[model samples]
Target chain A: MTADVQTLASESGCHLFSGCGFPSPGLNVFEFKPIFSIGAFDFTKPMLLALISMLLVIGFFWSAFAKPKMVPRGAQNVGELGYLFVRDNISRETIGKKGDPYVPFLFSIFFFVWVMNVMAIIPFAQFPATSRIAFPASIVGIVWVTYLVLGIKNQGFVGYFKNMMFPPGLPKAIYFLLAPIELLQGLITRPFTMAVRLFANMFAGHMLIVTFSVGAWYLLGFHIGALYSATSFIVVVVLTAFELMIQALQAYIITLLAASYISTSLEAEH
Target chain B: MDGAAWSSVGYLLSGMLIYGGIGWLIDRWTGHSALFLPIGLVVGIALALVLVFVRHGRSS
Candidate 1:
């Protein structure tokens, strides 16, 4: 099967490049050699990007809010805009008035995801840290644990499970059929989709950018191919702009979903 | 509203995964092919719709 796939791939590559060696890009680009290792720990490009993104977030927020300004200026003004954006747009919109307390959590997630995704466009660090499933999976894990704990804490263990598995006001007999789905969705699919949604977006975005970039380079090899190279370069430019919007939108969506889950856990009924 | 819509998708996906997976297992066990998959998919969608209506369609 692997050989068949490779043959088909090479055939397609030849068809596209008219027998020229196109040097088609693949998943190999995502793989990286460890820069240095600390025993079991391996530091690589994506890991470095993640670390840098985290430090940037921390430093930016620290400078913005570390000193409380009665009249906001400089970093405080910028920080307030980000804080208020998350508070009003995501948290309050999703969770209502009581969402003020969770603003910090949602805000951090939104910006962290946004900055990590934005790295895909940054020169020299052209990789989205969230493209690695581990990062989004870990974030979703934290979200899962948070909402689960909140539900059990506020509603009691048995009550929370009951409320989650069996929606109130449903007919008694239908609960048997629906219970499994509800349980599976709540326990498994919720976090799974949450992580996959972000990871898949970043992964696909990175793949597209890489493909267009390589296409442009390969097409520029011949005089007649210059037009194709120019077209591919234009696509690369347009896609980069589009990717910027998607990165921010995905961050907003994940944070909004987190808030929604938290609010659902807190509520007595769906 | 958007939250409800997104979770509704989760409901649909989980419904299909759980029921369709069980159907596939049954097919494997019985050596029957393609028989249960369609049934599972339809039932999954039906149940997901009902759940969505209960969660979002009704006035709270």
Candidate 2:
């Protein structure tokens, strides 16, 4: 990664400001060298960002709810609003009334993902940790396991598969054609799409931002290119605003889907 | 409701992937070019449609 950066730097002849050539950002931007290593463990920028996001989520909620107030003031008031947002808007809307029990799970996933994505636009920390596939993949893995367990526990092992694969009103002969597809949908594609959806959104948003930001800075070098540079800078601003909406929407959709999956698992039949 | 809709999409994708994947393997084995690939893909889409309609389209 550093080697590519060096090549671009020399190619442009821009050690600080030497040429008007635009040096495009690529996959190398995503890879970060470890700051420090303890045995097999290596701490990198995204890892640190992810850790900070987790801490921010925990700290914010803990501060807001540690001491409950009768009338609610300051942090408690803000905390209640967030709580209700997840409960009423997401859980109740998607999973129905009984989804209240899973509100905490949904709330955590939503806020954690939101904060991680929002990091992309933050001034100093401009990279979204969720852009890395591992984060979303791991979270979806947990979600997958949670719903699968919930289904098996609520219905007997055989009953769970029976209900899932054999929906009523289907012809007997069609079962052979449908069962494998249904099983794949339930067992594999559900989680696969969940992970990819979040990862792809963040990944593409970050890349777009980098492309414009680099173009703007690169074009600023020549007097003749200044007008185009300003145009690129304007695009960067617009894209940043768009990224904010996408970040929040992706978080909400993932949480909403998670709740829906849990609710489906708890059902006696599909 | 949204879950059912997304589940429909998931069904279609996975069905095509699984069967189309099998067809690709068959084509490779026999060196028959593209004979089973389209067949697999159509069958996959058809089965996925049936699964979606049964699961989400019908009124219980």
Candidate 3:
């Protein structure tokens, strides 16, 4: 709906002084026409971007570490720095010595999400794949299953539930009231919030940029409105820079939370 | 610490959902308007706070 309005606005040279109203971006901005269809499924732009992000992550790391060098150089140096950043700052900080085994997982997750989010400002591919809830929800599903399985493996089936639902040192009489809350929090709320956090951040960031971009375009006239357009353009640039930082910060936060969840599963939380 | 903070949020949300839901059902069964919903929400928040303190705050 808004897409058609945007097209009409742009094609007809609609501006602040023009008879046509502002072409405001809305939820419709997130909707993309399918590029192709295979039977029941339709291939879309976000899906393609997500696929490219995954391949980019895999290809970069594969080439970087394909041939080990005692003295790191070029891509290897950059790759090692990225790898060590996740290892030391995120994984180890959250999961301790046992985190070494999961560094690869965390590294892949961090880079993949970062790349997907960075796509928002990358020229033609100006959309963050993580803005789509399905992407983040799927990642959260994997994390959810991993921690659940780890908890069962490490603490045994009953022990895992017991540890999760009944925190030690709580009053015995309150267990009945608190147990249900704990179970629901761990089982449902954690994954739901994790997915929503990433999706909402990217979604809001994209929305803000698009709003200002469209505003800048819509306000460009041969009058005082041009000044407002320039200001809107400036806001867009500032928002883009802010989003870059948020993208990295969100990636770090999600990965950190994943590591902590894994750590909690590996050993019952005290 | 970040993990703990996030967990506290989750606890509070789930507490509200669970208890507030129960309250809504009770209101339905008893035909009392707005009687239990607010009460349930308060109880839920209190319980969530207690749980948060026991799990995270006590460590310090």
Q: After superposition on all CA atoms, what RMSD does each candidate show versus the true structure?
A: 4.9, 3.1, 2.0
Q: Write the residue-wise lDDT of candidate 2 on A27-137 in tens digits.
A: 877888898999999898889889999999999889999988899999889999999999999999977898888899899999999999999988777889999999999
Residue A92 local lDDT, model 2: 91
Candidate 3 per-residue C-alpha lDDT over A39-108 given as tens digits, one digit per residue, 9 for 90 to 100: 9899999999999999999898888999979999998999999999999999989899898999998888
- lDDT-wise, the better of 2 and 3 is 3
- Global lDDT scores for all candidate models: 0.86, 0.85, 0.89
Model 2 per-residue lDDT tens digits across residues B1-60: 566777888999988987888788899899989988888898899888887787778754
**Candidate 1 residue pairs in clash (backbone atoms < 3 Å):** none
Candidate 3 chain A weakest lDDT stretch, 10 residues: A1-10
TM, every model:
0.91, 0.92, 0.96
Q: Which ten residues in a row have the lowest lDDT in candidate 2 chain B?
A: B51-60
Identify the runs in model 2 with alpha carbons over 4 angstroms from their true place.
A1-21, A268-270
DockQ of each: 0.80, 0.77, 0.84
Best by DockQ: 3
Task: Sort by DockQ, best first.
Answer: 3, 1, 2
TM-score of 1: 0.91
Candidate 2 backbone collisions, by pair:
none
Residue A18 local lDDT, model 1: 64
